[model samples]
Target: MNLSPKLLEVFTTALAVPADQITADLDYQGIPEWDSMSHMILIAELESSYAITIETDDLLEMTSVTNVVDRLKKYGIEA
Candidate 1:
């Protein structure tokens, strides 16, 4: 699957948000749906989808959709 679509799925499913509402500018804690619980869900979904482990610091740094894409790239994922 394409990275963007997969990311949308993760965000949509984890945060229970509409796919159309997901954008690169979408940020963690920016919405009620993206609370601490949903944040971990998003992290797990991303890790499982990318088949890569993320550092704790990276997890903490994942503040936005664009940030996720950039961090995944650091792991050699073509986001």
Candidate 2:
């Protein structure tokens, strides 16, 4: 649970996945928990978590854990 609590909650809710399945190594593909609709849900979840917003470019670029973290940082979010 190294991720921000809000982020973690959103990931869990959007992907319908278990805590054990979540990690920095996890990506948006090759996993039953990830899909197109789930991706959109993840976007919304992330926006809500940071209490800010993301752009279409960032949203489409969110392919892995690192991407998510980096984008949050770009938004001046510490988590």
Candidate 3:
């Protein structure tokens, strides 16, 4: 499946990157904009958008776009 539009929006907004730059290969620290602070912002945006609380373990595992999609899947959010 392709990356969800909502997921892409969250990434672009939180990381301040263009949508074209947010590929499946994108990972934490892969781009300068996706730093520590932005990660928290990403998490918050995700929580609010999906209406689910991401646990610490899941948070630690969300290192890449693919991984984030996987984590969201566990929450029943087909991202």
* Winning model by TM-score: 3
Q: Which residue window of length 10 is worst by lDDT in model 3?
A: 1-10
- Which lDDT tens digits does candidate 2 get at residues 1-79? 3887767777889889987777887889858878889988998888886777898888888888777887888899765
TM-score of each model, paired residue for residue: 0.88, 0.87, 0.95
Kindly provide the TM-score of model 2 when superposed on the true structure, using C-alpha atoms. 0.87
Measured on C-alpha atoms, candidate 3 has an lDDT of 0.92
Q: Rate the local accuracy (lDDT) of all candidates.
A: 0.84, 0.81, 0.92
Error of 2 at 58 (Å): 0.8
**lDDT (Cα, tens digit) per residue for candidate 3, span 1-79:** 3778898899889999999998888899999998999999999999999889999999999998889998998999986
RMSD to native, candidate 1: 2.3
Order by lDDT, highest first: 3, 1, 2
**lDDT for model 2, on a 0 to 1 scale?**
0.81
Candidates ranked by TM-score: 3, 1, 2
Superposition error at 71 for model 2 (Å): 0.8
